[model samples]
Target: MGLYPDDIEAQASAIITTYRDRGWLIATAESCTGGLIAGALTEIAGSSAVVDRGFVTYTNQAKMDLIGVSAATLDAFGAVSKETALQMAHGALMRSGAEVAVAVTGIAGPGGGSAEKPVGLVHLALKTRSGLVDHREMRYGEIGRDQVRLATVRTALEMLAAAAQTPA
Candidate 1:
């Protein structure tokens, strides 16, 4: 069986605790995974200190309007591309005043898949004062939409934890 949301919540709790101990704050910019990353972090009590905020920018327009993702980036790289993901992470950091930020965008669909980008394709980006980190993941193609989202959330939380460790 796949991991549950609560399990992801627990992981996020650990992440928040670690970051809080080190005096860091985090923000999230989400697309296909919605606010699952932020929701997982907030699920833990006293997450306010570590979790600055979360932005659920599910649409291209929202990404631009809410997070300052440029229209040029979106047009040049598409919403799911690493370029857009990096821009989203940078935008979240700029808007949320967090020490670190994580962004996720992808085609999590049973319907939106194409030959180049499949249904389970996910792109994650992490931004810190030092630099940006990015990852592209393709989860098991057979899993349903819910499972794909869950996988993305877990990966995002893990990335957040890793990003929190970076010196700001």
Candidate 2:
């Protein structure tokens, strides 16, 4: 695996400090980045107070089973889609006791490129207990698979940090 980005570490630390101080917990639902978001969070000491758990739903079945991602949504919009990302984030909130949840679905590949959903296309969604959802779509252009995944992780961390800052 490639080196995890420094900004991700900083973002994770900030998130931990913010959430730990606020007595808030977080969860993650991941696809292309696997569990890197969770990994980054856990890399920080004392993250247990902030990180509740992680769902590494690398497969469609895992996504549906672990986080309640709808099969219809996956079939209709495909896995790496805004709709799926939204579902993943919401599902994580439902499944965990976390106040904030972040989800990432993407095509980080050297091979899985299409005309529309090309490689390095990532969709991130942040869901809060206040019933607000924020979605971001990133096109990192066909950077190497590790680079794309790291970029996605960084974006997810930023979203989580922002969501933590939002007033509940």
Candidate 3:
């Protein structure tokens, strides 16, 4: 079993409430985590005020088309790079008119693990008008795909809360 959606919803609700109190909006660009972050946020009642939008760009092409992630960056560093994550965050902020944005890209797998970029290697990026924050985390090998994605969603919400609390 995985973390329940309601549990994720509760956390997301608290974060959104905090942001709404401060009059800030948030967007998300998700790849390996799929739309789990967005789904968690939207599961909360009255999330419309704080959640601007979510982009589920699971493929290189989708990242380019939806969030304007450059093909060159994807070619150079693959979809899981910090550069791609930053670009995804920046693009979400640029396109969604949100005050803050979080982006995630990673290789979460039982397959698709190069020795360099192993399974469970996740890169997360948070972008605001003021600056950007990025993190690379390896979640102890393959903990199953769902577990990795759930962890990613939780991490993103935590980052969102931190970002919302920051002075703009």
Give the candidate number with the greatest TM-score: 2
Candidate 2 lDDT score at position 16: 96
Q: Between candidates 1 and 3, name the one with more favorable lDDT.
A: 3
Displacement of residue 81 (Cα, Å) in model 3 is 1.0
Q: What lDDT tens digits, residue by residue, belong to model 3 across residues 1-168?
A: 133566677788899799889888889999998888888887777889999999999989999999999999999999988899899999999999788999999988878879889888888999997775655554547898888888888888888878877887
Number of colliding residue pairs in model 3 = 0
Q: What global local distance difference test value does model 2 have?
A: 0.91
Write out the backbone clash pairs for model 3: none
Displacement of the residue 114 alpha carbon in candidate 2, Å: 0.5
Candidate 2 per-residue lDDT, tens place, 26-139, comes to 999999988999999998989989999999999999999999999999999999999999999999999999999999999999988799999999999999998778999999
Error of 3 at 142 (Å): 1.1
Report, for all candidates in order, the number of backbone clashes: 0, 0, 0
Ranking by lDDT: 2, 3, 1
TM-score of each: 0.91, 0.96, 0.92
Off by over 4 Å in 1: 1-6, 139-142
Q: Candidate 1, residues 6-113: lDDT per residue as tens digits?
A: 678678879988989988889899998889888778878889989898999999999999999999998888898888888999999889878788999988787887
Q: Tally clashing residue pairs in candidate 2.
A: 0
- For all candidates in order, the CA lDDT equals 0.83, 0.91, 0.86
